[model samples]
Target: MALGMNRDVFITCAVTGAGDTAGRSAKVPVTPEEIAAASIEAAEAGAAVAHIHVRDPVTKQGSRDLALYRETVRLIRASGVDVILNLTAGMGGDLTLGSVEAPLPPSAVGTDMVGATERLAHVAELLPEICTLDCGTMNFGEGDYVMTNTPAMLKAMAAQIKALGVRPEIEIFDTGHLVLAQWLEKQGLLDGPVLVQLCMGIPWGAPDDIGTLMAMVNNLPKDWIFSAFSIGRNQLPYAALAALAGGNVRVGLEDNLWLGKGVLASNGDLVAAAKTTLTSMGAKVLTAAETREKLQLKKRV
Candidate 1:
């Protein structure tokens, strides 16, 4: 068997996201307790890190409730698991437009726009090992809602991340988001060697295509550590694909819900599947400690 270009790669399990996906999958953890348990489980299943986002326990909708984040992080840390925790700094930026004609007043129903500082409230308070910074804003899903992040907003948030000594996982949804991440690095807002997560296959963002993945990878800084994943059925395939492209891999219930056809997946199941795929390709899956060193992350007490 030919050795893969990258022989070692780390897997990040996104436990849950700030998307309305809980309704579709019964296994998606909704409360603080469930999220923490799921995170620890993923770590045991061979994920180097757990990417997290909390939701309203009652409605099962994505939430930015500060208390919820604090409790979730607390539970995970208290679990004595060695997994690296990556909380979402990607919340509080949803912009749902009421209508195209009357875009004057943005829809209040699902829109959670706030100033940059307020958006990082949970991140600042919890100070996890890593946090995500959506490098650019774009239309998110089928709704009029957009994932709102401007350069100015990103700069402000990045500054706080620097001050707090947390690493920012620059999320590149499309090619241009990578450009914005590059600009942020040049401006000294980001620390090196940078960490980036290529979010592909979302509507209005980069398509989940090999050409697109290589193009994005080609443009990244040589020293930067990057991971790539596609949503839905493409999730598992992208695990090996990313390693082949010389990047790490991300997979979890947040981005996908099934381990195989007709098989609903837990966070651990998705992570275990990714580990199996990467190892089969002659790559040694990295542990959480190795991942922390690779990313040069600062641990918060």
Candidate 2:
């Protein structure tokens, strides 16, 4: 019916993700040093928050190493940049099931499933201002892979994160995940104002389309905060679109790698591009302090 608009918005830059993108682009940060550097560059380019995922420096694959998380956060803090730290608790839940013939046990080559307590080990140790809680499990991509997070698992993770005083950024892939997140809140497992990230354009998740995005928006809780983004080419467009939808924005190499069709982009370039788009749309992008106040984040513990 009516357009949703917010005069002020905040930009979140998801630095290096655990996906298999390191080989495709040299700009993807592998080690903690590079990830930290990229996050600072993003903040300088107008990202209020840095949503980070560490990779095994040796393998260049996404890792859940507490040591890696510690070093990454340390370097970012040492740099004296004021970017809000948002570490990912989305690791340790990947499951690649067995083939049809011999499906007795799931494949171990890709399955990294662990208990709820183990999944939040890094989050509890690092205590980032924000950490993601993937609300539900789904067929995440090609192969037999499933990103697993049962209601029992989510409840345990949310309670632990709440105890740690870190805000849980509920990663919403499908509509049902949103319903599950609300269920968690109703159970008092998740308290206070929550943040939801509408992750569209991923396979086996919500599609990246206007109607789909709007549907997710319409279903959002009246008082909860939200930010939306799509991967690849839709990434830049979603920055402005998310702002128009009355939500905050997210952009970085985590979702897309190109500054243009033929160009590879660093995190800074993506954040700068998103900032330009949002500004052209007449929305004032908020700084880290402003975002902190708006989100009501507690002091970093």
Which residue pairs in candidate 2 have backbone atoms (N, alpha carbon, C) closer than 3 angstroms, thus clashing?
none
Model 2, residue 197: distance off in Å is 0.1
Q: Candidate 1 lDDT, tens digit per residue, 90-116?
A: 888888988978975888787888998
Give one digit per residue, the lDDT tens place, for model 2 in 204-295: 89998989999988988788889999999999999988988889899999999999999999999999999999888889989999999998
lDDT of each: 0.89, 0.91
TM-score of each: 0.97, 0.98
Give per-residue lDDT, candidate 1, residue 79: 86
- Candidate 1 lDDT at 115 equals 90
- Backbone steric clashes in candidate 1, count: 0
